[model samples]
Target chain A: MNAFIIADNIISPLGFTSSENFDELKKMHTGVKRLEKSTLSNEPVCAAVIDTNKLDAAFQKLSAKQEYTRLEKMVILSINDCLNQNKNIDISNKKTLFIFSSTKGNVDLLDASLASKFDKKRIYLWETANVIAKHFNNPNQALTVSNACISGVLAIILAKRLLEENKYDTIIVSGADILTHFVVSGFQSFKAISNEVAKPYDVKRDGISLGEGCGTVVVSNNKSLAVTLSASSRAESRDEGQASAIIISGGASSNDANHISGPSRTGDGLLLAIEKTLKESNVKASEVNYISGHGTATLYNDDMESLAITDAQLASVPMNSLKSYFGHTLGAAGVIESIIGIHSMRENTLIGTYNFNELGVTKPINIIKNTQKQEVNNCLKTAAGFGGCNAAVFFQKHR
Target chain B: MVNGTEVYSDSSLPSADFIKSAYKHFQLNYPKFYKMDHLCKLAMVASDLLLKHNPITKKYASEDIAIIIANSASSLEIDTEHQNTISDKNNYFPSPAVFVYTLANILIGEIAIRNSIKGENTFFIFDKFDADFMGSYNNSLLSSNKATCCISGWVEFYENEYEAFLYLVEKEKNELNIEHTSEQLNKLYINQI
Candidate 1:
């Protein structure tokens, strides 16, 4: 019943492929930069946005005749690249299911100017998902997960559940979101968008740096799964000449029930998710090799994570937040960050929390401040979003 | 309404007026209902009715119950309101309250808060009510021991059109003794009997 990661891709400001993004991270590079002026916001803001020209060129190579929204393009390109990595699984097969995860899909179409160009139905997430599914000629209607920031992880969790139930042999999970005036203005109103590149777990961290990106991963049971690692990792493991399959071991979701817009002050909600995930995975807290935190750099979120990590007895684990590198990609954050975590485990390297200077939260936890090589066997990814929702998923390297 | 059968209210009223009247008729005292957007209000009313007959919260632990809800519009009613605020750059004024409801899952949060149900919560979007997926998914949750019971169904609110059909899915057979299947869901959802 193990849901193994067969292939993956990340389309973001830093790079198109997961390896490209990982390489950028290894060099301590970040995508977030101050935008002097942009259509996403009336005032100057900081965000990690993909280049329009680059995205168009990439999509053009796909040779798609029909038109698609920016979010749709990212999703299609991401899934296409992921499919290209491992050609073993046939997406058209009825045994394969498609799941689209996003906080907003083609939500920009809400604009009158944009609505007139595309079918008004494109504004609906389910409709946009169907468009992506139709692109692949997949007969099964794609399932859409729109649970705020945790949608990506939740989608993967759902896939694992289905795979365990022997429902689908392969599941293509893609999570994507694009920067828009709608989201930018909304976060701006909340004063959650940082003025600079976000500094997760940093004392001077002011707010989050919103970004846009897409990430896709192919999850399948052992029947269709294979041991596939990045080229560098395969070369590095040549001494043993062994390939390990990274499995989606277990995951759980919970709610704070405290507030819709705010995280719980006690971190109990997130702790509950983390504890359930650990127990379900049958992995003790001490065995965790690395921790991938949500870390939006907002005052409440970072603090809540620190408390949760400490409370879960994972305070000593080497933890880092990728938000500093890619910005908080919302729906894409869970998948994108989880993909990066897989890469870290495969390469035996830990990407540091970029811009982290001093301890910011009340609790003490080991925060990796610099990219370094480490023997990572298992990684835990945790996310908390608006609506007081929290989710945690565990990934393990199975040889 | 309970199981698609109207318990006590006129369905001919305008969608908004119907929801308001249902709130008054049911005597729901939660003040927060007044501030929610149309989508959340619809979910609140539907869930209130569903739970009124079956208080699953009292029987199951908070973490042992899950909620799986889906719809077509996906909070677009309030999304439009939020979009309108920022559409005009000259008079841009986006409120956190409106911006928060832009996410479809906030309604799930509302239901969770009202019932103190903190189990596995998920919000999905589909073109229409996909009973096959919902039925199988909830069955899997129950069979896998993820939840003892589930509050699962469809709740949609967009423009002035609205419909909510939420039902409780539990392991034990209830008084109705209806089997959980896609066919049963189609029948219950279509006829609203």
Candidate 2:
């Protein structure tokens, strides 16, 4: 509950910077478009994909060798932006650890027949992480978090625990997952992909649109360091001499104990996590100012989230699902969305859902239909994933 | 360290039959056991052995028990199996059953459901066993009141190569027979205990 998110960035299709991505959201601009049939499949599918040319240009600035994969490039670019803003911190220091969270990192490296002579070691997520860490000159071996979609938020919780133990001074938490044939086909097989742009919590909502993105948040225990970061980025990120940050107050994750791919119809797992978060933060449910819902727009996921929100007594809070703008970035969803939520709280403006028009769930809950300006103090970010894993993280704005 | 009971397979027997024998030895009736992939079966069997050593159903509430599994291979074997299913153009069928167990942490879900553990769970992919993480994380969870008892250890399976050393961690030193220290943890992991 003490760690401060000193810096953050979301590099995606909408834009490379958090503000750029947020500006698109303010205009209700979507990154989702029809996937190229020759590249994805014959079936029509809409997704939020990155422009390959822009990535190549950014990668050229970062390194001369074109060794990093598209996913790794995005992750490095995102973290570099955060690290650039915090020039005072020694990024390669031993106390500075990095956690890479992703659903399927480099799963595309595997040959289709399992007989391709591709280096079998490249298939390891840790391998990709080591390459990224070495580029940053980080002394410690990067920790790989590959636990379904909740990996991003879980990394934040892991950082908090380790920081509490005084094991590290800084934790660079990065989450990224690029769309690949393996993932696209897997979701396609599950019949969970949306043919059109996703409509979260809307009656016309069909399914999730797969997305590609990378998000990084710099969490440090020292308060003075944050004051310096805010001072450095006054024009771009904050107001004049306003030294403030969002502290991670509470975090916990639970299993549905019901199914692997499907969420619990009763929303028991999410309710348990939210209850734990509130108990840890020592805040009443009504104290939460905003809710960052992980509405993948899938039928059962959205419905279950609504029930959980109501159970947590947070149904009255304004909420938005960024997935409608950026699509579901798998491992990147939790951190990317949380970073935007932190910025939104600082600006006192919550962006509306990109494509949501109607409420379809049986549980009646408040969904932010239009961008609203209000005083914000604390917010809750929740993500559920393939393993029936549900994570709820609470962050509070520090005065 | 396993308190009073422990189970280990030398990889001489088949994985499926070994798991079946475990269900029979424990006289458990969870029908879902057979449906799990190799990685899940490995974790569930290990947890069954540990729970048989130190019973939790009567002492602690279900929500107080958390599980954390760390592995090196991380569902590689099952991933290959699933990859095989969709590799060929003629047989392009990614069955949800096999696809469900693709993530290593799903084993946590399998163990939690069987034991009715409704607490926090996470999976970490480490190149090798990390004693420091295993000890400190378990202690931190207990200190923060996130979990009363944590079932934490290493689980890895790919092809016929596999190793699992699940340890039961608690706040009370007297609760379990073994000392929950990094040294003791490494000993248990390396078969020194």
Candidate 3:
């Protein structure tokens, strides 16, 4: 049984909706900019912050309660958009599973509660799931994943498994994270924040620019024009195959085992993930049309990722990172990038790697320097996170 | 298959003779790093028990083994303590050492490093156990061939409550045992007798 992404909604620094974001991408526009004067200095002023009040008002029309935090509001709004677009789908009685992908589920609320001694019950992670489920009025089970940067993609894979097993008729996968002082200071302490707008795959690229956004895809057995094909042929096939028609044919997650905060210099873990994904998809490295990398513009990350792709013999695949346009959205990066890749494939165009003039790392891979028109059939999206966790997903246009 | 082991700081830890004797035995026999967290200690103990009389370590490369852990609380007891140092108005600075443990999956990394096993790794969070999800997730990992052997289980720790169980699962050559579905495991562990 194959699973497909029927509809999607995204709220990012680039734009608030899919059409708006796609339009900006078509024009090669970037939303990342210098922080306002009132923001902190060490914090690295570049970020993708959504207007919370506007998001809240939009959600209030769909929800009965209005007390959710910015993170919750983003998720609610994104889900609402997905449901609205995929109208009249009878999820009311189906076992509609909810998979929330977030590194910080209202962690800002937890941070605030620490200072104000607010009610502890309101800040619990489970409560956030409950709120989302209540708003949807679905009977299916709900789960929240907090797997650092890989949470978003992991959630989608989990939903795919659940749907394949006939456990739920509809699976709503949503990822949301907000720029908070807690996250800001943590990245800043590691010197992982860029001073200017992020420049992925560039020789002068410094570090990541933290951004916040929420994105969701409603996946079901229901097929539509928006459906992106899976690389894996069977739900149970384990053999890593060569790259094929941009299907999410097969994928895997692994840890570098070298460092908690840094990727392995050898790209050992990343190679394993890519190999597994290709094997499952039954495709070869030469067949991969493009690679959407987890290029945070950080010195270590880009270097390691470049090495991994090259080692996997995917030297010719056009590679780029969307972080230059929207900054690193942390937990939301995986799904957001996947959505963007799907859009690019659908439009038969390749998005450029923003702010790239000189090649930073010595690798044979072709770095996308400017927006180019191309026929893309298969694309691979990969992300690595703090706990040495790495994930890779393959996408192909549905035939 | 997922495998795991655990240690808990029960009220009688220091005075409990049997537990103390167990600790001494581990100190003399196992690697020094195994003495860190209860989860790691338990993993070492359980792995030793599971690997006993088996050729898994020698037969497979380190990268063939993987660890997937699901937990609640998310190292919160440690997180709260870490936050307290930073929360104080006068000394509002977070500790880098403590902040590292904020993620639940680090336990998997620690275990993999100690065992020299490198494969697929993931940390999942749920309020309570769901047998269906566990079974499906493990099957997914195995079916994908991400790991020839998977060490999967639950490790929950709060201020006073700690519970952990790890199971080593590999694909069975023959037909699966019908009785060992995730529903059965969930009922056995999550639903108390």
Candidate 4:
């Protein structure tokens, strides 16, 4: 009962589609930019924020009758694009489930000035999920995952579990979060936001560069549903005889039980999750060719991840974080990064850590500094977030 | 209260005072209890009561236990407090302590730390308690061997209104002799309410 990625889309500052975002990564273009004084903060900050004009215009083409919040619009566009690519998915059918993941959905509604535009209930994540599901006319109540930064990965894991149970033919996992005064200010309070482009796994790294985006991945137990767009693109460009089926072989989540806001000092929690995921995937450590790290570029996070990788005996595997490209999209990070990992496996290319220049962590782990062509078959995507949460899932290329 | 059966309740006491009184009555020794927000406090208290008599930590391995909780509002109470810390430009002083609790899953983290049960844990948001979904999901976890036992149910705290209905799901039937089904969960949950 394997869950395969049928199609995917990413709506971010880098691009609107997964391919577009991947292309930007290949060219080493970062979406992070400096802000003089955005409404999110009184002081200048650095973040990767989506252009609302572009989003509104793109969403307008869908001809949606009602207005949607920024986060909802991004989610709809991402899911709609993903569904468009995989026409076999009957979104409105009972066999399909919509799972929305976000740490702070419509948190902007907390502010009185922005709260007036929509119903007060829209501030609730469940209400926002209902709006998104109703837009597709999906009769089932869309489930919402709101687990800090790990929400996206957890949602995908839940989808896989549901699919394995044969409860649904298809599951659409849409993870999105928008930059708001609430989040920005809170992160600022934690002193966790970098003032410049994030440098993951680098000595000079300061903190995370917060970003806003939406990523949707449609997964199903049936691999014949639709070939991932990235795989098709690879088939077109390269003379690859047959595209490997991209499947989510396994996933597991755990809590550090150490600290609420900080990662485990021992990295045992994440190591446990990684070990369990690989065991469930039935793949050995040596088989994992690449690692999609949840590198928030924070001093402690990168160090903690390196320790986890080393302890998991995956230190030599080439790993890279997409935070430098899209900043830390929080809930969207796991989904979009895993989608890129799927593309990397299909195309046999690995995107580099955009701003990484040196090894900073105590343990030695292979950190990709530049984009390179390689044989990427199995990718281990990892994420550690607030609430002492850590999740690891594997995306494997099945022949 | 344990599973809607009020262990201690006083209509005259405020919600906060009631929580404190219950904590005192239970003789909970965890000093960290005071630092937790209302949501986390409610969850901690409920979980303590549910597991006090039948400690799962002794019965199962730490990794074999999972916590899956669902609630509406989703830390809006703490989220509002965090927002207030930053909403005012004139006196903007956001504390990491308050900001960290803005996430609903922190409550699960608190529970994990208290019992040191580290396994699959997720926080879900729903408009209301969905017994069918929670029961089926928890059952799937147990059936799939993802977890030998799961601590799952609804824990909602917002605007001083709090309710926590958590029940353990294990393979072996207990003295309760209740089947793990949606109807059974709905009945138990309604009884709590």
**Candidate 4, superposed: residue stretches over 4 Å from native:** A228-231, B3-5
Off by over 4 Å in 2: A36-38, A64-66, A112-119, A232-234, A237-243, B1-12, B15-17, B24-26
Tell me the lDDT of model 3 at A122.
Answer: 44
Per-residue lDDT, model 3, residue A65, is 57
Off by over 4 Å in 1: A223-225, A228-233, A236-243, B3-5
DockQ of each: 0.85, 0.66, 0.43, 0.87
Displacement of the residue A63 alpha carbon in candidate 1, Å: 1.5
Docking class of 1: high
**Residue by residue across B1-193, what tens digits does model 3's lDDT show?**
2222243334555332333355565453655543344444444554554455344657666777777777766666656655565555577676565566666676777666556667877777777656677776778667766677777777776655655666666776423343447876775575331
lDDT, model 1, position A137: 86
Higher-scoring candidate on TM-score, 3 or 4: 4
Clashing pairs in 2: none
What TM-score against the true fold does each predicted structure earn?
A: 0.97, 0.94, 0.86, 0.98
**How should the candidates be ordered by DockQ, best one leading?**
4, 1, 2, 3
**Per-residue alpha-carbon lDDT of model 3 for A50-108, expressed as tens digits?**
76677766767875554666777788878877777666344466577778887767666
The TM-score of predicted model 3 comes to 0.86
lDDT of 1 by residue, A124-196 (tens): 9988989998999888889999999999889888889888878688999999999998999899889888888
Alpha-carbon interface RMSD for all candidates, in angstroms: 0.8, 1.3, 1.9, 0.8
Model 2 CAPRI rating: medium
